[model samples]
Target: MSKMFWLSCCVVLATCFFQMPTISAGSRVHRVRRIVGGAPAQVPPADDPKVYLRFAGKAAQIKGVLDQPHYVFRGIRYGLKPSGKDRFQRPRQYFLEGDIDATLYPPPCLQTIPGDGRVIGSEDCLFLNVFTPDLPDGTEGLPVVIWIHGGGFRYGSASQYGVRNLVGKQLVIVPIQYRLGTLGFLSTGTPELPGNAALWDMALAVQWVRNYIGYFGGNPHRIVVMGQGSGASSALMVALSNIAKGSISAVVAMSGTAISNWAVENAPMITAREIAEYHGCPTTSAMILLKCLQNVNAEIIAEGDTILERTRLTNRGFVTGLNGMLGAAPNAEGRFDGRSLPAAIEQPPMDDMTQGNIPKIPILTGITRDETKRAVESQYQSEIIEKLKGIPNFMDQVLIKNLQNCTHINDAAKNGTKQSGGYFNLLNPLQFRNYLKIARNNFIQGLSKIAEATNDALFNLPAFLTADLWSKKGVESYLYRFDHISQNKNGFGHLFLRGLPIIGNNTAELNDTVSHGDDLAFIFEARNLDGSAMDPPPVLSEEDLKVCDEYTRIIAEFARTGKITIDKKPVEKFSGSNFIQIAKKPKANNNFRFCEMALWAGLADRLKSSTCQFLNALDTTVKSAENLFFDTVAPAQKNIGQGLADTQKAIGNTAQKINPLNLFNRKPATPKTKTN
Candidate 1:
């Protein structure tokens, strides 16, 4: 490493900043919730009765907490650290150079997760953790599920979820941590700062597993790549990497797909430029911008953008949902001299089966009942209501506008200037016709309509589209819709964390909203680092544990064999059905939609309109304030009126400032949820 690199490292430690953020365009913008007191100290290893693991002619002591039936080996280095001279380049392998100390997780890649103002993790944070069962003797090559955690592309680490529940099924579970935000994703679309380093981070980590997992008792050949939310996006992308073609045997892209508009960053160059300018980095050229960020304090580079560090896209200080996926994305700017859009991942994840460009592998993809509930929380604010009203077609967009709140517009206003000759209804039509009257009157009701439309357009339909594409391509594709509302307060099960049936009646909860990521808590046994050292680990709710059992078993079955059968029932694939609902019986359901979301997504895909395009335009439109420390969105939107009015006005004023004209006016998606 160069002397200047070492000196810069010293300065970074000297500055000792906390909580970082991400790079240009839709990166996972963090609005972390800070916890009081310092991070609890880690418990020392047990009595030095060393547990050694040897693989590839190299050996290291196993690292992880030893709970019964499973051992979690954490913070195992799998690739060269993306630091010093190697920073911004594609990840390289980093074999064990000394005795492996796999104890506490290595610092997470430097980025904001759970917003707290304290410098966290390191740049050299490329690591993977394994959770293996204390299986019977001679139990070699156990089926493996490689997990990728979701936090948009800006947040999350392998430590976010646990494989303890998974290993209970006698499957090896590996959760890998790659770079996040600007560090793993920032690129200039040229040889100097080519992007998709984040994807390569996963590719290299998988390669490491293929090379060394046997040492930890994982099956190299039967690897099943799995993820939820953005992690699911990564899982789908990893299968597309040239290096991971054979290494990844099957995939479970939960709650996301290969084609979600939020999947890829369409304009990394401009995003990079914007981030550089925001931080006062040398933005003269991509080379200068790359070097300036490299030499700058890593903390500053990660947390510098006041616009992002302090912004929360929603009401609850930023959490994962399709709406929050407005930042950071995978890029077509291939690593090094590789293809701009590689053959493996070239086709948009939303393509039809005949569109081609997919890795030939068994795949399972699905979504939740109300994936937009969490996203809709942000749309309820008065200013957003005003903005939604500004669009003459807002009502058309939110047709199922609270099917609960029925509305009527009398004959006098019915034929009024609502068409362009306009009011709220547009070319798109729906049964819920009186959308304009409801939106004009009730705030929550109107927001609900928009949320439903946006959710269907962004998440659910895209999920259906990609899964259907796999089935069309003749891949072993399974589709599921999580309907049990018992765990709606925290997650969307099957595709996310975990869920449980109600004590006696396991039906969708009427009052419960099955928000996104609610499924995370049920699937993995996450140990809360938020608690004090003396506090006990989170007690599992009966429903949570039960659902974990169901989901883990289903995942294990697919990991081992490419198909799933839960409750002694054969879960039908998407080819033969609309979807298999993840309930007690787990049966198929074809009559799914109640609104025009699939209509919206299909229109989006047809018109080539996507989240990436809309979000990219916001870079110029949305201005930032300050408090990124408390809420991820504190900077961009301290006040609701200031947050969106400025955004809409900026766009209206400077659409030409951005490279692409007609930023908001673009093709809409008409997602085909069924094969026909």
Candidate 2:
């Protein structure tokens, strides 16, 4: 092992005991002692004492242990407690009084369980963890990476993911915990309170990093904001918000898009009030509702597990809400005070420092092979069917309609069944298959309509359109698709006719498919208590490991430099063959072109076609080829084309009419014509 790796291991092992403060100059001799069953021995002088630094009128201490040659601070507070009246308000600068305990992690924000028995969460949770090799020498500043965790919009925490492995790479890493669900997302629109408090918290954290990371060896100007899921979504918000201009240098958004349907149309005040009423509040005023909610026990708030449960039943499964509404997400109202874009203009906002635009910087965006499969397996078969039982032909009609719209129904079906086995039965297959189809179709339809809408609201049009705009502005953009599948050798035969005779093929298939969050274990390089890599062990073989390593290296490299390519080759043609194939063997030319096109074009179309007046305002811009190209061509077109191609390939020779009940063949029916 290299000196760095050995040093990192020493730091992690010793962290359980003494806290190291600083490292001394020189090559020091060391002795080792064993603690765990067969693990390596601990080096003497486990940790340096905690060090204190004062800034922004607060005194905070940094606690870390020195491994071979590095020090790390686990959890540190960068802001004040945002509880009671402080809830939903912008985070205040954390003021430290005396020697603060910087060794242990702090509690995360309040959140609720989804009735799954897993701990839901809390709102008193604005804390950040920092890891550094060693304090910087004289004038050198270490590059920093700030990671945001993902959990849709309701659940997640930094504590769940550890970064010791990445820290060993020699970069300063900080994982931040922000308020989620009702506490962090609540908005009143009153002069006293604005929505998007969670976003503001992130902004505060960034500001904190800019001001404080230097003490621990981080460069304020070299910070990279990275996240997955909602964390990715929030990172996009920061990347697009005026508040983050000049603060963040680049961003890494995993499986997230910038503009969301939920965020643009829904105002926090409307949803926050609704949630309050659901919780037994009797007022419409946000402040009053918030005040009433403050007295309610955290457990009472957590009990709203019914909301998510019901959402699982609704035709539109898991509606993204303020806490749970379609139109509830962070938008201009919170930051821009509801100002409409320039009149008669067609382009979506692009400047990061202006209005709703976040700072323009290098970005890395990608999604998993079966992004929706986990969500489907988790709720579609059981929860959705139960909810739709009373609706007239809802499953059949909706399923077929959705299938027709899917860009890769057949491929998804084949892959789904291959990965899932018999789990992709006739009844359940339609749910997953149709969902993918309709999502793409709707996105396309929405973009077309937005192009025709009047030039006022262009919210949905901005996501793909912005990507195009950014490319024009000379910003580097890279996109990726993660198609890895986790399956046992015995599981493959069940997905094809060759293995249908198996008694429990369907059940066994579901067992093999790549469900959501399955990739997380690999991405985070998680390990079990026994020190073995987590279940669904790293998919790549040695050859593939080189690729995986390269992919990771590129990600880190991009974080350091604003480019995704190391050579002069166009990013579009630079396939990620160096990374291990998450499912199949790594191939040199397998780019995510079609998928990218579909997403960009479909999203633009969704924005155009939506009945939302705000989106309708962007019609003029969508009409012009230049505008459309600027908005959709680069990002969504490639993905869309790839998705369509994949879908066609999956359907194979099946000429069966699109039937929602048929799993692989279905599409959304046009709104029924009414007889005169």
The most accurate candidate by lDDT is 1
Instruction: Count the clashes in each prediction.
Output: 53, 90
Per-residue CA lDDT of candidate 2, range 26-72, in tens?
A: 32222233386776765546675465678767676656666444565
- The global C-alpha lDDT for each of the candidates, from Candidate 1 onward, is 0.57, 0.48
Q: Against the correct fold, how does model 2 do in TM-score?
A: 0.62
Q: What is the TM-score of each candidate against the true structure?
A: 0.71, 0.62
Error in Å for residue 534 of model 2? 8.5
* Deviation (Å) of 45 in candidate 1: 11
Best by TM-score: 1
